[model samples]
Target: MINQLSWKVGGQQGEGIESTGEIFSIALNRLGYYLYGYRHFSSRIKGGHTNNKIRVSTTQTLSVSDDLDILVAFDQETIDVNYKELHDKGIIIADAKFNPQRPEDTNAKLYAVPFTDIATELGTSLMKNMVAVGASCAVLNLDIEVFKDVVQEIFGRKGEQVVQKNMDAIKAGYDYMKEELGDQVGAMQLEKGDGKKRLFMIGNDAIALGALAGGCRFMAAYPITPASEIMEYLIKKLPTVGGTVIQTEDEIAACTMAIGANYGGIRAMTASAGPGLSLKMEAIGLAGITETPVVIVDTQRGGPSTGLPTKQEQSDLMAMIYGTHGEIPKIVMAPSTVEEAFYDAAEAFNLAEEYQCPVILLTDLQLSLGKQTVEPLDYSKVEIRRGKLVTEDLPATDSYFKRYEVTEDGISPRVIPGMKGGIHHVTGVEHDETGKPSESAANRIAQMDKRMRKIKNVRFKTPVHKNVKHEQADLLIVGFNSTRGVIEEAMTRLEQDGIKVNHAHVRLIHPFPTNEMLPLIQSAKKVVVVENNATGQLANIMKMNVGHIDKIKSILKYDGNPFLPHEIHSQCKELF
Candidate 1:
């Protein structure tokens, strides 16, 4: 019995390709199989090649598998475009309607199944995905009954007959494939899974859930690819917890609205991708100077303009770190895993309030959208820390309150607008202790110094996710966001080939984790900073903050796809 399998389903966009993969992965996740899923789609609503590749294993796995074991194709184009990724013994289950032809050099087996015919005969063509799923079950020797619960949950609302028809469609496809393959019916049977329950979700789902759990009462965002899911999730769940989501007119409005909400003593946030982040830069500067606690989620994608809206890239490192005009204190966090995305998202609110500045929770296209199985979250681990925020009514004062009082720690006392003795000015211009506009040179210097010093003692936990296998490693591999899993898989393969490797994934990008990263860099003979950007932004950041220019190198990929494990392994081998 195989312990792992790589399967994919492909078709035109808006044809239930995503739902197919979701149903399949969800069932496997229920059985305790670890799964990692990635989707390939164009930047359109429909009529383009799209596919979802999922890797299922008994043990936990992070990256997509290097090769395909099975490909379920709806159209000839699906087989044509994705066949090269299949292994020699891989199988292709293509719909008979397309009469799919296998490419000459491809060694994978091709089975022309009547997916559409079976679904149409049962009820509707929309159930073609269910037929394909059944054919996949036959190939993997998985029981057709495994899909019963998921199908019911999906189609149960339609009626009892509809649910029965879908189930029948699955059974028909399974039986037809089973009879055709005879001896090979169980050829690819998988080893039994632990059957333990786990949470299956995308990073955006985790982030939204984390936000709600973290006491975020208001969300203002403009919908954009990848990042829109965060706001959408909040839109549904926030109201149940007495919170709400506002779809603002533009990214600028979204950001400023969030800042306003935060100033009113509510945890609020805005989310956007590259273009939207660009629009929110000026507003971010406002939050920085005004010391208004706000959380901003920057889901990074390929770009300078509206580049690769549905693809992967991590080019926003520098822009996110220092995009707004004039330097002001800001915190940028990059969460590598879905689990970290959750905890970091929740902690972002605390950090913003504690430091009284804007905190940007950074993610890449893959990390933001890729679906995977995650261990249950520990709600107890989430703690809300509102530093120096005065909640109680203070003694009424004749003079304006010192809302921005400079202190040794730089974090000033905060109060809601209606609080007694809290009537003070708030503006974007340079201000003194009372937040009044000021042009005094001394006041400007003091205010700048205070805001800058606020993050000097940031209480962030595990700024760098470290896996130091060796006290002194020959090479150090560094990455952030979705690259963490791929790098770990590559390190395992490199170790098997007799090379020592250590990994460091940056969680905190701004107020860089210099102290923690210094020793890791010093202990390694060489370093490779892998990222999805062509400019090696992360590598340069390491050099600028930690300063080990001689040993540091980069493994970059900016072709609108996340890094595969073998790609990383092959590149690192060249450095040695």
Candidate 2:
């Protein structure tokens, strides 16, 4: 049996829920435990309940699940709100003074630890989270040394005085646990591995690093939840790399400025969430018509209009696909893992330039904010594709240069300003072989077809659909973006249970990998589509192209929480 433990620390927004979770995570990671954490909170500074769930395993973990093994209640309301999620054999640790009227029939082991009271005795209530941490370690029989190392790592930079106080608080809580409940505690063992092999990073940082590697010289964005970290990370790092990062006035300005940077012969990127993406739609269309190579990273959040700004959602799939007006040929792709985010960002820039169109990298809030241990990307392995821009001297044109000069591949040779006789006019209106405003229906059709053809061509050049064990299984599971890791992990578990399962995760969403996907679906006995979005956009796309709608089953979630492997496995079992 897989040993899984989830700890929920809930309290008012400012009561150090995140700090406690981080401290636990640091300790667990140092102790060689594989962990996955998910956090939920309101968009308030104080008084609203916030909950952070951490899933820890002795083995590698890819997703966060629903069942809780331990609930560390900071207040009565926290226990009230999330008590039902605890497993029957689980434990609930709460403050003795604030015990709620829990159900008498419930089988969960309850321990009333006076966490706040202990913190008061330690001279400050600030260490209540620390108290919770110590109590949890005591119950789990986790190493006290691990907690000591975590405390020093987190608070040692402050000063000796603060560090000493926190350490004392930790020891006090540990002692309290030993005095109150002695040998009920049992230790969980973790497998040893080479520490240097792992690289820790959050999704936003990985995306920024990818963009930098892809020769992104200019970035413009307005701060928005989930996507804000990308801007913040790039802003500090961009200047060091001789690049420019601007915090624009709004999302509209951000997109437009990024387009302008692209026009000035630099690879440019802008990032935002659903609401901000709406603001950039008009400018996105303008980029499309002008054939400007700009990358827009829409780290999607829930919405039609500002719905759940700080929450996770894949609802923007349709919005990103058809948000722009008119026939705009743009590439849309999503990365599944932190490593994929890095590589996808670089590939996004390449596609934007090669197609001479805007590309939206559709990442969601889950992947954006989620932290994981990933392998450090090798910069030497990155191939920087700088599009068709020529730096060499061109033969002098008798008249003005034709920027939209159509070729066999529908891609025109592009030249930057200050290049000899390469300057040309770019407009949103229909243009001929020469770049100028034209009202002719024929020119419009040709331009539209040319733009669409570029997307078609990209299908051949881009990465193919990746499958883990496609050949050996009767059932196949398909997913995209952040769902990739969870689905893969689920497939592994199913295989272990004697269910022959295969999996495919797509990195290229648009121009959906027809050649690679059609054959796989045809061979599989059952095809299941898994996604984080409620409407099953990926499922719909597969039905539209692959022609086996009846065989494809969808397991979708849109509750502002990600799909856990256990959840997916349970769903797949139902289908089986």
Candidate 3:
């Protein structure tokens, strides 16, 4: 049996709902508890309702459940809105002033803690979230020392006075919970893991680190919602590693500058969200036509335009596949988790260089902001695949350097601008295999075929779909990007109910793993395709490639929210 606990903190957007959940997660992590957290809020700053959900367990957790184990309502609206979601045996901690009417049959324990009254009495409402944190600890029999340590770690740099006041507020709430909730609270202990571990990191930071590891020396980007964090992280970390991160004036400029840097012989990258990606499409085509090795990371958010800047969605699948005006062969890939993001970024750079093409790392808001702990990366094992640029040992010959020399593997030797006697012309018009402007129909078709063939060649060399529990299941669930963790968790739950299931996560999106995936899907009795996009892009692609649409099931969502394990389990049950 799996033991699960979920907490919801609801209040105005800026009233520390997100901070309260974050602090709880930090404390829980210290206790060796695995956690899954999700946040929801209006796009406004002041009055709209905001909620943060946190799921914690002694065992690993991947998704936040819909049911609440504990509900901390900061205002009357919160109590009114979320009381129905509380479990029958759950607990509700709320302000005393707003007495909510509870059903007679409701089994949830209710405690009125006077949160605002206590904060007002303490002479500052800013400590309200800390009060809630302390109260939660008291009622759950959690270690107060953990909360204290987190406080110090979070606010120690601010000053002594701020720390003291927050601690005082915490103590006040703790005292109140002790007096009211009494010994009914339960104790939770966790088993310690083996000493080998990795520092926790978010997906955006992982992507940035991976790019650095891949020898990306220059990055240019314009600030956009979900993708902005990638730039923020790279800007601070790149300088120390002898790299540069520039904030360009616009998305077009950012992409162009990255292209320029790539042309100058450095591995360069740029990142943006949906709107910015649209703006950079022409430049993306430019990179494609010129066969410059450049990486573009698009951290997708909900949009056709700026539909939802701060929410999660997978609507950009088609955009990444066919965004440019003309037919341009570009490699597109997605990483399923924070750890995968690091490796995928490095691999993306390598693919761009190997194929002399632009590569897109497709990520979404869920992966961009979600946090997780993973095994420490073995940097020694990392292989940097630089392009065919000539270094110290190689010399330019008297014959003119052909930028697009036809080779067996469809990859040409690349010589950058500074290399002596290696200067060559590149243009957007149809070009022959020798990289010159051409209008000949045969040359155009050959050029297009050559570009497409390069990606096809990479499909064989790229990593295949990752399958979990491959040999022991009849039902196969396939997913990509951030849907990986939740689907894995769902498969575990389904197994408990005597339903065997396996999972195949595709990391490379374009020029997909047709050879491996076809056989895997064929082996399964039923195939369930899960994605955050509404149209089930991956499922459709699988059908187009393998010709087995009849056996595949699609579980698609586009609500600007991610699927919980319970939801996926329910869908599987219905299908069975």
The per-prediction tally of clashing pairs is: 0, 1, 0
For residue 427, give model 2's deviation from the true position in Å.
1.2
Model 1, position 293, has a per-residue lDDT of 97
Better of 1 and 3 by TM-score: 1
Residue-wise lDDT of candidate 3 within 1-576, one digit each (tens)? Answer: 235578788988888888888888777776666666777777676778888888776666556676887888887688677777787877888877567555465677778888877887887877888888888877666656767777887889988777777888888888888888666655222334333334556788999999989889899999888887889988988899899999999999999999999988888999999999999999999998888989999898887698887788887877888889887778889887787788888888888887888899999888887776655787775577775666653365775567776666667788877677676677877776656788999877777776667777574243455655656466889988788778887888888888778788887778777887887788788899988877888898889878788999899888888887888889987877
Instruction: For residues 504-547, write the lDDT of model 1, one tens digit per residue.
Output: 99999998999999999999999999999999999999999889
Q: How do all models score by TM-score?
A: 0.99, 0.92, 0.93
Q: Supply candidate 2's per-residue lDDT for 565.
A: 80
Cα lDDT of all candidates, in order?
0.93, 0.80, 0.80
456 in model 3: Cα distance from truth in Å? 1.6
Clash number for candidate 1: 0
True lDDT of residue 184, candidate 3: 63
Taking the tens digit of each residue's C-alpha lDDT, what string does model 2 give over 250-313?
9999999999999888899999988999999999999988888999998977666877877777
Which one is best on TM-score? 1
Better of 1 and 3 by lDDT: 1
